[model samples]
Target chain A: MATVIVHKAGLLTMVQDRGRFGYQRYGMPVSGAMDVFSLELANLLVGNDPGDACLEATISGPELEFTGSTWIAITGAVWDPHLNGQGIPMNTAVDVRPGDRLGFRGLRSGCRTYIAFAGGIAVPSVMDSQSTYLRAGIGGFQGRGLIQGDELPLGTYNALLPGNELPPGEATDLLPSDGLTLGKAKRKPRRTKIPEGLIPEYKHEQTIRVISGPEVHYFELAGLRSFLSTEYTVTTKSDRMGYRLSGEPIKHKEGMTNIISAGISLGTVQVPGDGQPIILMADRQTSGGYARIANVITADFTLLAQMRPGDEIRFTETTLDRARLFCTDRHRVIFGI
Target chain B: MKEVTLKYIPSGDSAFIIKAGDVISEEVNLVVRKLLARFEEENIPGVTDFIPSYNELMVCYDPVTVDYRQLLGIFKKCAADLGAMTLPDAGVVHVPVLYGGEEGPDLHYVAEYNGLAEEDVIRIHSSADCLVYMLGFTPGFCYLGGMDKRIATPRQETPRLKIPAGSVGIAGEQTGIYPMESPGGWQLIGLTPLRLFNPDSKPEFLFNAGDYIRFYPIDKDEFEQIAAGVADGTYQVRRTQKIDNGDGNRT
Candidate 1:
């Protein structure tokens, strides 16, 4: 069996799948890859299922050693990765022989990265998911993050193509870094002509729309107006659990001490008694007792995940029709309709 | 009967909330449990999960398959039929515990804070058969009702980083089990040898949303034996309640 040995683990690295669903009622959070787009793309490039388990590295990538021949691809956040003291390109598949060393340095853009293999990593599924929830200490590599000398087992691989025929691309040189070429690399192949009305323009800077929540009346008129109009900067304390936004303190109608704990979800902006807004993320708790003023639509949640700490974010008020249209469009793209 | 107001709030894109009261009350918990039982019997078309809290029920659904309007309709129907629904009969769970010493380090402080002897506190805690109001905060961690008001105390100012699993503790008017080792602010009085949660086991969770629990004190040696058995995978505990079948008998 092929194996990947962890030599130098980054700040935070964990194997993540789509997520643990159908367990929220049991008080389990849907812990998974923070950036779903990149994770799926990496898996797709390697001929694996889109939702297959992949390593999710935060900011920095891990230094690993392959014990057998395997095909691997890297995606998300321009991390300059190198194999055996040579460079490897991002978004393209590469072959690694046994005893080859692979590692990454710092990030060029983006905060997360994904690495997928030809055969998925073998890990036990907890509650039908391989995703790790560190808080509960379960799922993914003995319910913990990878440490030094951890040998992860790889499943058997089916050879679809010869490794010699695969084109070797330029080691992904992170922008603003000195160019040090490794092996002979080829340019990306030309894209095929797309059918009319098939392509969607990638939107980078767009206002996230949200719907008023059950506790909308709890906030004063001015607070609600500020929440919709003003731009708030995401604080450095952001994580999978929630994003703590720094903005005007939302004033409640009354200084309620303790509201009854209720269900919470991703993108639910809860204003605690402290008046600051906490946007719950993928690994948020099942229920909370804070007053939520608005919930970001599912379509815009990926944009929120891409946001870096200190990035300014503005909430745009939109009707349910607009939100539904956005969600339908996203679904169509995902399903290739 | 005291009049109680229940309000429905939207939880998210596909969930609704049925709140009974603001605080933890026996009457509110009873209503919440009864409503959950009715929903199970009806088996609403789109309702995927219904999580009952101390005074609220968070019902989730798939928005693609079911809309908020349809969920609201079913919720209204469930609320209307709630009066006639019979709650599942409560089962008394006698959980053996070892109090104080190495097993329970906070037992002395808890007794001193409540101005009662160690034995008195144990008696008060184990005497009443408490009702499981909700299963939340963590898996199998039951939020129980029926704590004696005389011994009621607030949570610890500073939460313990890791409380051992199966440790019986009290927080405010409610008492609960630490199903897993997690950071909590509850006051620990005793330890139980029972495994509150095990993912490998059938049913996964030891207790459901509406079961009754009683604490029976066990000695240190017994606690060690049971704990060892739990570790080696030989100990088995039954946490099911008898239900009436369609026939003229109870199963």
Candidate 2:
């Protein structure tokens, strides 16, 4: 099999597939690509299975050299890519001959970048997934991140068609020119009139919608009102496990003791006794003791994940019907249903 | 009978909440268990998993197969019929624990805080039969439901960066076993010699929700022997049960 050699491993690079699902009961987080859209796009460009294992580079990208001919695509985070000392474009396929070098510069806008090769990467599966769970130290390159001098085996399907060449175009045009502008332009246009049959805008700068918590009355009215109206900044302590937001301390109405630990899920914004709100992420524990204030809709969870440290976020109350429609529609769009 | 308010809160598009009560009491646990039993019997469509906490049960469903409203209705019906239902026959599991000394480094501190001798602490802990209320916090980490009131202790002021796997501990009124070495804040009293979870094993988990657990104190020599058996793949700690219903209940 062909192999790719890492020359300079970047900030954080790990092999990730879609994610590890149906294993949450085992206390394992769904460790996968942070940006699913970009990951899939990279795979689609190279004709790999949508769920094929790819390299997820965070903040910065890795430098590598190929030992055999292969087709590859890089997407996400507008990382400046280069092939054999020459700059390459993002979101398109590239043919790399044997002994050629490939590398990426630091990220410009987003936090994650995806690199997908034809046929996908070859790695041992743990718990039915090739994705790396860094916390558990299993799966993906011996269940860890790629290191310099490490050689990754390419899958049997990594072969390119005979005489396949790079698509005919000026590659520079494909490079995202104004990443910041593009991101803002992609958002829905602001409108005053609520059109019939059109899905309502769930995205907002402030006021995240929330339902009355299972233990809403357990907290005093002052604490509840403060949680509903106040703004909280995502703390620097945030990671894949959970986002610890700093805001006003929420106090209990009376002397309350410990509660039994129960099952928790992604987007469950739990408020501990200290009043700090923790928005659990994909890698959160299966259970916790804090009283949950609200659960962010799954549709908006990806957006919340994209927020950088020190970003301010607020919650607003939403009905079940609206949240359901938003989630269903977003899923359909994401999976191309 | 004390009036308890059980609120049904929507968790997300695919899940609903059944809040039994505010505090962790025997009654709340019973209601949680009763609801869990009914959900298992009905096998409602779209319901993938149900997790019970001290006072709430979060039921997650597939949005495509069933909506939040439909699941909520079923939950309400189940809550109303809880009085007529009986808990499933739970299996009993005996776990061998190695208490005090090096194996349980925190045992002395726990004993001193409880104003008892190390041996006395062991007696009180092993005598009580704990219920596995839920499997959460980590894989194979059982949220046990019993702790002698006298031996109950608060968690550490600051969580330890890492606690070894199989470490048994008590936090507040709850007692549990840590299946994996992770950063924990619980006050440890002892440790079990058996592996609680192994990804390579056929049945990755040693315990499941609704199971009964009994701790059996073992000497350091026995603990080492069992640990060796676990590492070498010769130990068989799981007990098999036969169910005639042939439905998906057992699986």
* TM-score for each candidate, following the candidate numbering: 0.82, 0.80
Off by over 4 Å in 2: A47-52, A68-71, A93-97, A156-213, A216-231, A248-260, A334-337, B1-7, B25-27, B30-48, B62-66, B70-88, B112-115, B154-161, B185-187, B238-251
lDDT of 2 by residue, A94-132 (tens): 777678899876556555678887657878777777888
Residues A270-297 of candidate 1 have per-residue lDDT tens digits of 9987778888887888777788788887
RMSD of each: 7.5, 8.3
A280 in model 2: Cα distance from truth in Å? 1.1
RMSD of model 2 against the true structure = 8.3
lDDT of 1 by residue, B39-142 (tens): 77788776666777778887866554566777778777777766555554566667788987876777788788889998888888888777776666666667
Clash counts for the predictions, in order = 0, 12
TM-score, cand. 1 vs. native: 0.82
State which candidate has the highest DockQ: 2
lDDT of each: 0.72, 0.71
